[model samples]
Target: MLHRVRSKVYADFVPEFDATSVAKIKAAGGIILGKAVTTEFASSDPSPTRNPWNLEHTPGGSSSGSSAAVGGADGSGCAGSQTGGSTCRPAAYNGIVGVKATYGRISRYGWAPLSWSLDHVGILTRTVADGALMLTVLSGADDHDPGSLREPVPDFSAQMAEHDRPPRIGLVRQYYQDYATPEMWAHTEAVANLLAEAGAEVEEIPVRGGPPVNHSVRAADYGPRIRAGMEMGMIIPTSAYLKAQRLRRQFRADFSEMAAKVDVVMTPAMPAPAPRDLNTTGDAAFQVPWTAAGLPTVVVSTGLSELGMPMAVQFGGPWAQEGRVLGAAQWCERIAGLNQAPPNY
Candidate 1:
């Protein structure tokens, strides 16, 4: 999806998807799957694809087709986007695994920016192992994106295998209980119980006022940054954007402190499932704080709601801890026994 978008927007953007990308895939013993549709510019615009589980509902977007393609009968798994909940929401809506890595973990060089500060490349798959496989292929620093970090990308799949004992997991008390729907809250509790039964020490903890600051900073920066980028040909405002950066630093500090006590944090990827209408994508409130703090988050489907829509729980870790985060999410996914296929293909 991102490859197609980049190729369309920038003429100079040569997509690796052509013979070269395909050859690379084959060389690596992979296959060329069909292309998935993306929201224009990978923004708020929803795609026409319906939820695989129920044709009457949306599959979620910008990575709409990607999520649907993964959750749908093709079941190849998805590589979605997140500038808010684009990836997480759709994965939950379609009952698949979605991963929103730490900001800058995956190079954003080819992706069209919605909110430069908030945008992230994420994956949606039916299993945590598949998600990790895609991440291993896609992650790494790219020269084209200056913001892309130079850190070595670890073998995420191997990390998932290394852990024997369950780690201490922190349950975010505020957002999960406050914003989620009754069904969502119930699903979350069931997930907590499953994690505990799997030997994880699940403890409820208060996430301080970081979410509000995260929302505010993101709100204040997105509009102005995009406007300035349009009018003056810049990606972000150097001055006002500083506030978001500074706030992010503080957010990282708070999250790091929390991580010191718990190996991983569990929260819902979105407050609820996909909205009824495709005209508007659902809120990304649950995901903002993680993006703001530059932490790695993996969305794993918990179960289907009474309405048959999907619900997911987010497993997160401190910056540069992608391996640990993916491992824990895989653990939770196994314990929950959620591996259902969506209804539509």
Candidate 2:
């Protein structure tokens, strides 16, 4: 039987009502396995949930508990929310599958809000198939969530139904490679070769514009530093924020054009594997761009890092292309041959 655990954000903040995603899970015959931990208000504040891979290491957050639980034997899967790397980062850190569908792809009706513009409901599970199946159940427009997109919900599972050939994957190595540890870069190259050997047409691709510059706007609701910035955001002049929004639209346009040339874009999910520190979740740099552009992204474990912790690669597609993004991720998941159980599990 399948179960969907809620995060602490839902438990502590809004216990009375099931988030739209949670309601969908129950309707689809999934058990509500109770709430997992979340960072304080889903921000920089740390949670008690440690990485299952290494108890001393950090489990990425604010979706910490969701990812950690899904990485364990006790839970089947859980609903995570990502404003930045909350979804994909934790999945990568814990060595599991995580999906951040396009912005508004999954209704946020009852989910707690961070940056309304950037927050997205996400899925963390053991496999791409499970992620897609859960996504199919959780996706669709909700009358209550004004931010919800009205696009038709396709059978996400069927979209991932096997393909005759591997996908043409575009490698965007500039920012990702620049920020990643050498070991991560090398591991990524090795995985690319593994995929190519399995028949994925891999090619280098150039990128314009770097990571999004509005972390302040997104992280405003968080801790002191970010909250200070959030306070500034309140008085930063509407014109400036509007200008940033316009620039963001152009960024989205550029990414869409780029996506036209490939079945999926691949990059390291995080600059490095789960950091040894539990003081903070790993950096969100690898995920901010896609989240900023509202593109669909999937994180799959590539293998364990040098420390025997998991390493992962994230694949993203144009907006609302969850099916394509997930399909490619599913293929890579199979060929990468990295799905071993974490030690101690």
Clash tally, candidates in order:
2, 0
lDDT agreement of model 2 with the native: 0.83
- Per-residue lDDT tens digits for candidate 2, residues 167-283, read 999999888888999999999998899899999999999778876665543453445644664577678787888888888888888887787789999999999999999888889
- On the 0 to 100 scale, the lDDT of residue 309 in model 1 is 85
Can you list the residue pairs that collide in candidate 1? 52-344, 53-343
The estimated TM-scores of all candidates read: 0.85, 0.92
Per-residue accuracy of model 1 over 1-345 as CA lDDT, tens digit each:
322452234446555543322333356566657768776556555557788787778777767888888787575655567876778777878788888888787877645666777778788777888888878877777777677868998888998667525878999877568888887888888888888987899998877664734333233323333334455534556765677678677777887778667889998777777777867656777877777677788888888778888888888888888888888888887788765776534
- lDDT values for all models: 0.73, 0.83
lDDT of 1 at 144: 71
